[model samples]
Target: MRAGVRNLLNIRTRRVSLAPPGLPRAFDGFSILLLSDMHLGSIPELGPAVVRVIEGLRADVCVFAGDFRLYAHQSGPTFETDLRRIVDAVRAPAGLYGVLGNHDTIDDARLADCLGIRMLVNEAVSIRRDGATIRLAGVDDPHTYRLDDLDRALAGAPKGAFTVLAAHTSEIAADAAHKGVGLYLCGHTHGGQICLPGGVPLLVSTRSPRAYACGEWDLRGMKGYTSAGVGASIVPARFNCPGEVVTIEMRAKSSRTRPARTSCP
Candidate 1:
């Protein structure tokens, strides 16, 4: 009973809307369901809850920001089974994409492929809808096992195409902005994994500014969000910081006007 209560209290869905400059009219109102830092092996029971939440949400695409496992070396068949089940439950017409996180092994790619997730390791792909195109890029983990290659990730993106990048850590927000990436999505901090009252994080583990630790932030001309994550790490308990799945709605800004820049409260 206590476990069930904790699951109910700790997990939630957060909805966010963004209108980045230069978003294509064809892709306006596009919605993406973003999930990160699942840490499946660490909190096994969280899987069913995550699956339920994702299956209930509506999205044009679904993107995972990695850390699918807790202990890299210890992740085994159990982890794969839980991950596959969660992945299968997600529904998106545009498709599903993911990147590797610090806690995941290279072999996790096979599991992702089997589950119909395209693992993007420092790569980019373009998706089209209703005669409009947007580029989606992903880089490897930028935290512990750093292997991120921002240049290569954006290499295939066409000039002036609206681009979104999926990275494990918000530390790359600045670089992504400089490269003209319109939006950057990430999750790894877990909002300190524990916190003070009113969801104030005590210690954010990223190299980025504390302002970018969790929630949305504007980095120069780009927009970025660091999710609190869907599972806990280090310990199976969260204080004021609850686990979450984020839904980002994309709207197109008028061609003659610039989009307003905003930061997380």
Candidate 2:
């Protein structure tokens, strides 16, 4: 138990590179810092620990996949205070964006906006560089809330441009890929908060396939990554699964990459 407790302070950085077809060359090597599931109210020390990890890391953009607090109804002032501290520590040059999770409320979305993190609520945003563009479409929580509208989020997006979908869980992967999403970013499973040896999760509380529970996965031709998360949920201790702050590098893949298949989960 002592080792498990100490594991909370052992947050690590996981770096991954993604090369998706149709990605804009101008956006090649585009770095995105992905953060999720920081249930600050569950563990008091998590807030500062997360801040310390992300203080100097640089990225082209930053995004938060939700669960600002432990419970969905928790709206204390300190939750806001700690969230602000974490948000202020981010170092993304393009901007910071976020999406709400099952354990979040509309109020949390509003608070994220106040803190300079653009909350994407069933909408999309574009990051253009050197005349090339990539779209970031995000939807509401689909796990428990069931408010996600993938079609609405991708309404105005161009068909040929690369699109990255920000969802709270991999449960929405099927729909996002059907709508031509190039990459999907999410975090809710916490990589199975308590895993067996070899990082095998004992329980991955998600409706999607187990493969999408923790790390990079491919749905058809779409590239996806589900963060193990930065803070623990339910319990503050982790076994084989340590908390993580992920940095993803997106590059342009060769045009000859296979076309997206019709299968999905």
Candidate 3:
């Protein structure tokens, strides 16, 4: 999942197949759209950019992990407007699901309600499509408001249902894998905004250093891709890393083996 930012600019509306080779016949690929950290108040243009991406991609489900707005002390209609623009632009394939990120203040709560987004606050919702049942769960921003209880979020889920977990932090993958999640989508690291010599980020605002950083990584029992995020943070500059909206095609992994494959944003 760690690729040069220059490579992501080449991303267009096309099927970049991610189905691992040697997949069993039991499952077909699941189409998923992943976008995070738009920071709408900071980068207003990001809303339309994301809408265009949404229009271009043909997907089964879409996930916006978190950080809808930049931190604003004077929260009011203007802040709500910024949040509304971003949320309204998001056209989820199935539905728009989200959590809050640290930069997002109390304004996020009202925005979540106003935008009609299905805010998942440490809870899960089950939905069915094409005869497949999926368990979707999301947690609040762990930084300012942490209510991440993987067990509680996933309680009573059907034993065989496909599970997707969305969070703002990539570290949640460790717990997600232990909870038997099939996929986890997160965006906190801006793909190492200032990439280092080996494409590593110099500074990160996340609670924990990004282990997965930006791009795909496989945990013990789960697989996921972390978006570099659409907007900026802190200094608002990107070097070797370009922001991205990740499109992932998920095929069920076999219990017997992990297939070798290559993926991009």
Against the reference, the lDDT scores of all candidates come to 0.83, 0.84, 0.64
Q: Kindly list the per-residue Cα lDDT of model 2 for residues 1-265, writing each as its tens digit.
A: 7787688778888778887767888887888999999887766667788889999698999999988778886644467778899888998979999999999989888889999999999999999999998898889999998999998989988768789899999998987888789999999988877888778788878899887887888888999989888777777788888888888888778523323331111
Task: Evaluate model 1: give its lDDT.
Answer: 0.83
- As a TM-score, model 3 comes out at 0.79
Model 2 TM: 0.93
lDDT of 3 at 222: 71
> lDDT-based ranking, best first?
2, 1, 3
- In model 2, the Cα lDDT at residue 254 comes to 54
Question: Can you write out model 3's per-residue Cα lDDT over 140-219, one digit (the tens) per residue?
Answer: 77655676677778888877666788888876777777767877778887676667656667766666546676666777
Per-residue alpha-carbon lDDT of candidate 1 for residues 44-79, written as tens digits (9 for 90 to 100): 566777888787887889999999987788753468
TM-score of each: 0.92, 0.93, 0.79
Worst 10 residues of 3 by lDDT: 2-11
Judged by lDDT, which candidate is best? 2
